[model samples]
Target: MVTLLEHCRIGPPSAAAEVSLPVTFFDMIWLYFHPIQRLLFYEFSCSNSHFLETIVPNLKASLSLTLKHFTPLAGNLVHPLIGSSKPVFQYKPGDSVSLTTAEANEAFDFNYLTGNQPRDSDDFYGFVPELPPEKIELDSKIIPLLALQVTLFPNAGICIGFTNHHSIGDASSIVGFIKAWSSVTKFVGDEQFLSGNSLPFYDRSVIKDPSGLATKFWNQMSIFKIESLPLNFPTNKVRATYILLESDIKKLKDLVIFKRPTLVHASSFTVTTAYVWTCLVKATAATTGDETDGEGTEYFAFAVDARRRLNPPAPPTYFGNCLGLVYTESTHEQLKGNDGFLIAAELIGELISKKVNNKEEILKDAENWISYFGELLNERISGVAGSPKFDLYDIDYGWGNPKKFESVSIDGDGSMSLCKSREFEGGLEIGLSLSKPKMDAFAPIFFGGLHADDSMPINPKENF
Candidate 1:
């Protein structure tokens, strides 16, 4: 419906080269292919059933008033393969959490957090039909483009959603900006935005020197194909989730502790991924038709931050695509032998370490990985499964750390998302996602192991 009178215009949208999403412009164009990245993680914890009554309007006003503050990078939200990728000013109210408010409370128990269907397209950024010219500001609801999605569930809980493409800012920056908007709208402080310092430059040239530590680290790592082998059922599979915690993390360390004969205890990232994978392997076996044969293949993948490996590593805030995927592969029979948890955990840790320890490998394999990911993306677009998933969302902003944060999946695709929960009563939060069936299987295994520690006194009604 764009007209000559339109003040803003973007070219027709398509994955083709009508417009190139250069590495420099990756943040903006990513939302076109991976729009979910543009979503804001919201947690509405209110006592009164009228949470939305107090929150939604405040969120709307904050976004509207803060329009000018929305960066071109953050403001860019695109729908893939459509015309003139305009921002959808409307918000589509998301349905309530997968489980009932009560059942959910009984589960992980978020103290009865709740919300209902999403509202208008203006509130939620609508899908674009295609990619368009880069750098064009959207002309949806606001000139600067701000979207307010309201999800009012049955309970008093509500979520005020906002999405600004990464081109405008990254997770940290968005957090700062959101805090600013919340401050103004809710009558709070603006320190969030005030304290945010820009990240270092985006120069990959630092990695140019292969002999340097950065390239050495890359040389050792192998980016292998990762997939979930059915631990038990034809349908059973472990979805991706990057989570870690203090207590169980200790348990993991304890299991791998020993001498040179001692296991190669991996970092929390490696152990946790393996822990989840083993849990999946074990749980699926529990649910299998033949409980005895534990020798099925179980697998998962994780990415390492290569920024620091560069001659100088990209600054923490340098942002964009700074991750490289590393995977772990093995059979269920192998995982089930003795302590599958320990074995899987060790393998993940050793593999990641080997890759990270050798810096020279990266420079040599940089282009190879780029090409690998490119092919991977093509496969994903073609609906092929097993695309690598990344999780760097467990960041704590001075808030206490989360025990475990994960995103639940939707759509039939295996894509995952979720948030990490703070160990303390109310610490910082983490968000992530995953597909449903896999999530259902994973939740049980995690609780079976994690809930073993009864000290937390989690609310009886709160769902995981």
Candidate 2:
């Protein structure tokens, strides 16, 4: 069990002025999507008194100072009630972010929560705070952009949880905020030593939507009431962590090339996602038998950061969302067959190569994204949450590198999270949420395929 200790409001330092930022087309894609929730565990054994006196105060102060630079985070997304006006992030003088403090009972096992083994998905909900409910104010709807929680495990470590509305920012923007907050904490709330180059660029005008995609996307949001979207996660799911060492990725790449010699883009991201997608397909077929009809389409979707791809490339630190979707689909039979891995890898690699090379094509289909995603909402689709490029393990708040980082939002959808390995260089960590039966069937298929000889075929039925 977990008990709430305090609920405090934190804002930027005194003298910080109000600011407003226009929402871009990229941001509208996630306007009605579920919020992104994450947990970062740090192992620092300390008494409750010491944690309250030192850690709590330090984190609160550092976050306040950090918000002075990232003002939008402490603000709210104001969606205009009038049909003509677009949504914008508005920060008033008294605007602040919610910070909750909680303590977990002794029964909670810190090690088990941070380990690679499967654990109850509900165990993580306590650490993550929820975004404030949307409110109607004046002529606009006010939605909180970010909320945070710090949970103490008594003599064990502490867990820092973050829940942010997807419309406010993407992973890159959030990571930048954490880096700034951590830097401030490490230096004891000192901002002088912080690097200016690392600061976020909040100029939304840099994102050019030549096709008027923003207005088009805003019109699509009317199709469904935002309140109707699913926010409650499934309780029967179990969360697990899986690792792919450097050698495993190399072997997977080699296998793809051997099967499809013309394959041009077999990077770590492509191969890892392809392999996981194929494994999930087979696992679902083996355990649930829901999409085994061979004719059903299995879709794989993920977002690509378009910061550098934009014309007159936006700064690397450009805040808010600058992403494009890469959606690919295949028949169930094609994905669960003997050559499924190779097929997935080739399709992903080809699509990625095309998008990476042709910048003009990135937003060509932006208008159809909502409808496309809506169609696949309840279908046999799988998506990815985090990216290996984030290097999340490197985030240190003076306590040390994170013991474990998880994207808890994956439980809502059948998506997975990927990040660079914490202990191994060039390795990758994949976080998965599935029912017990599916997870049991997935382990062998995932590990057995990695260990199998090059000439041998991986039979999911045999493994099960």
Q: What TM-score, over all chains together, does every model reach? A: 0.55, 0.95
lDDT of 1 by residue, 14-104 (tens): 2212211223222222222332223323344454345335544444444444332332322333322334342321111211111101111
lDDT of 1 at 140: 31
Best by lDDT: 2
Q: Please report the TM-score between candidate 1 and the true structure.
A: 0.55
lDDT: worst 10-residue window of model 2 = 455-464
Candidate closest to the true structure, highest TM-score: 2
lDDT of 2 by residue, 285-396 (tens): 8896654788998999888899998888999999999988878889999998888989999889989988755788877777888777777776788889989989998788
Stretches of candidate 2 above 4 Å error?
Answer: 190-193, 224-228, 231-234, 454-464
